[model samples]
Target: MQRRLITSVLLGHYLSAFTALGIPLYLPRILSDLAPGTPGWAIGVLFVLPTLCTALAAPIWGRWADRNGCRLSLLRAHAGLFVGFLLAGFSPNLTVFVLALIIQGTFGGAMAASNAYLSTQFKGGDLSRALNWTQYSARLAMISGPILLGLLTAQGLGLDLYRYLAWLPLLAFVLILPLPKDAPKHGLASKKAEALGELPQDMPRLLAVQFLFSFAMVVTFPYFMPFGEQLGIGNDALIGVLYSLPHLVYLLALPWVQKHQGNLLLHGLALLAISNALQFWSVHAEPLFILRLLSGAGMLLSFVGLHRCLSQRSQKGSAGRLFGWFDSSGKWAGTAAGVAAALISQSFGIASPFLVACLAAMAAMVLARPLLMTSREIPA
Candidate 1:
């Protein structure tokens, strides 16, 4: 890969991933502030909306990147995200917050633009390493963002949480500023989609995998803390610690995923299924933390593998559309999962969410056939 391409792609991916992470990090505090007496179900929905939006946005942006180019549309997206997420912070009501999420969704897609361009422009394992590091950067944000938000919010910086959140997009924008200029064409898949044009045909299954994979994970999301609280796991501080449990292990798993980067699909899918099964053992509070961490470890593997899968496919060109579509599908699945969790929690209790995840993982193995190797080697 060209030095300029690597630099630009990672710069963009690194910034945007953290930029997106800030919302989830601050969500509990934001919702608690909004609904002092709000039911757990409502808080769960608020926490999930952003992911749903990102899921929806990724494909659109990916397509835009395909037709246009990476540089220009990404800039526009960051600008809008700045406005949108800032608006989310200011939301006086949950409805307003959800609106902001929808708006935020408009600009928030997967990182297909950066990855697609770099893969096309680069050769060898350098691109793979770059992708891994970029993935780690995002995981690193998952590691750091919540801790910083918790500390800062405790310090009273959160009184202006929404306004403060605007800084995220701004910060990411500044980081992306140093990026090399993208090709003169428009960016993201759909932003510049031409008539009769389409992304990879495998896109459907890839996106389906992304959805079910996220379903296996996100099914647990809305209930992570609340279930803990129900089982008396910890107060908010302890809850945050437990909430971050998966991310903690994901850090350790990062190098492992990179080390075995080849032939990741079956292992990733198998691990995902196992994680879902493990969650079944976590119904009570005591085992929840360990179960959650195991789940994260599984996710890191599957996601990196999925990233490898998507990257390899789109290496021909215009990966943004493909990743975007995959991203959006995953988000919708998470959304549907969230909605299901909300409804189920409204009736059965917190364990229902995880039950849903476990089932989803089993179903995912059905479609993972497309991702499976004829043998052990990951095709490139």
Candidate 2:
């Protein structure tokens, strides 16, 4: 049963990952077709809306899952995404498209839901390992999603690609159907426990670490392309490879990292800060490639460490609620990161975001110290 559940949720997460990450690549084109002369700010909104909506709505959905069942919440998320995609694919006007994105964000948190669902099945080191697999699916999807969509677009699917992509969530919905029902483990009593301040004290602090890590890392993403261009790496293909390098590192090193989990969070943050700092001076492709590899390695260490921390705390509280807020913290930070990147790049240069990221990573290391130190003695 554990194997089946993990496999199903991972597969479903893969499909969702592909759609969630892949579809955005074409949003600019879609907006151009539906609303010619779309303002730059509106295009910015197009990029940020789904994530912003997801950040806002995740906690509510998570609380609902604690009362209801994870399976139902997962199914509902897929269903909501299906509807959102259908509306997006068939949107006749900008208003409708915006609404579609709103729907998608509000109802589509499959990855977080998957984490919560898996948390119910595993705990301690096993839960960390399980979460590692979920990240694998996500990394694979992130790496392949755009390339596959580019292939489809090259095949002349063009704007209609949006319509075809809508079916992915439906397929994911089917993949989830065979899993045994995951009834609510926490129920309403856990809610009262939390409201009465009876849950674990470390949860909110862990979430702060999540937020800082996410912000520090993602703040560098929006301006990465320009940063690469400035480094004399102008090939689009090469840029894509650079973008994928970190996720590739995760695929290769995550298992080893998972097994050797020690004080990885602090080490990872230090590595991340160093990598980002080094990138500021990388004036050629050779050095930039090495820096990216280091960045990927740092990301892996930190993510696995954080997952382990969250898993440890989930053993003491409601997994669904904890992972829900966990996902929300990252999403909210990610949204802020994008805006901050834009402002920093505009005010300073394309590379300024890296400096900010380095500072943030160091800050995160400080916030993470208490958690990691205490977590060492916790079982699993």
Off by over 4 Å in 2: 185-199, 261-263, 376-380
* Superposed Cα deviation of residue 341, candidate 1 (Å): 1.6
The model with the greatest lDDT is 2
Per-residue lDDT of candidate 1, residues 11-63 (tens digit):
55655666567556566666777756778666666666667667666767776
Residue range with the least summed lDDT across 10 consecutive positions in model 2: 190-199
Please give the lDDT score at residue 149 for candidate 1: 67
lDDT of each: 0.65, 0.84
Residue lDDT tens for model 2, 1-380: 77777888989889888988886877777778789999988898889899999999998888788767778888888888888888888888889889999999999998789988887777778888888898899889988898899788677664567678889999999998888776564544655555642336888888888999999889988888888888888797898788889889999987677778465888888999999988876667688888889999889989988988877777433666777889999999999999999899999999999999899999999999999878853333
List runs of model 1 lying over 4 Å from the truth. 1-15, 24-53, 86-100, 123-125, 182-198, 229-239, 282-290, 374-380
TM-scores, each model vs. reference = 0.80, 0.94
